[model samples]
Target: MDFVPLWAVVIDYILGVVMWTLIGRFGMGLFLPENTSFFFMRFFVQATDPLIRLFRPITPGFLDARFVPLFVAWFFYMARFYLMPWLLGYSVMGMLSFPLEGEIARGLANILYKFQN
Candidate 1:
């Protein structure tokens, strides 16, 4: 009775990655311009450009270019945090809704607890 659908996990993980990538891009953009030649900045731009373009139709013109990554990331976060759980018939975001971050947090906590003891 504790099983969650594999499809649900995959979708949650995919959305999680996109959300983090967008967040990372936003964080990097704060200190680096879009035209920077640095590999990491370039990689963020390359990875998230398609997503930004996909959401341009819904993105507000009033928002600044530097904020687009975060704006896009919010949608993914919303879908993962709310939609997935609802779709899975969960009243809250349980493990199924946040498998990626949830497991990572749990693993880190265990590691820290062991170290502390």
Candidate 2:
């Protein structure tokens, strides 16, 4: 199998994680009240709030502010699922085409091994 370069592997991993966080934050909003004191929920809110705020002003007047998470999630979804892969010279086949967790782990292991040797 062809090895993915370390930079691509790292970037893909980070993008996937951030995109997943945005999705989770959006999903949590659907059921939990935003003011809930749960720890993970609070962390998710704190983490994604800036992105939501960035998109807030462009939000349509008819759409409620609570829905901003969904829009921010969509933005990260597009960046992770489409833009990153395209920039990396891969066809846009969604997450399946991105680097796997194991691949990133292996790449990091290889880099560390080389540095030590």
Model 1 spans > 4 angstroms off: 91-97
Candidate 2, residue 10: CA error in Å? 1.7
Q: By summed lDDT, which 10 consecutive residues of candidate 1 come out lowest?
A: 90-99
Top TM-score prediction, candidate number: 1
Alpha carbon lDDT of each predicted model? 0.90, 0.73
Model 1 TM-score on a 0 to 1 scale: 0.88
Candidate 2 similarity to native, TM-score: 0.68
CA error at residue 87 for candidate 2, angstroms: 1.8
TM-score for all predictions? 0.88, 0.68
Off by over 4 Å in 2: 91-96, 100-117
Clashing pairs for model 1 are none
lDDT of 1 at 61: 100
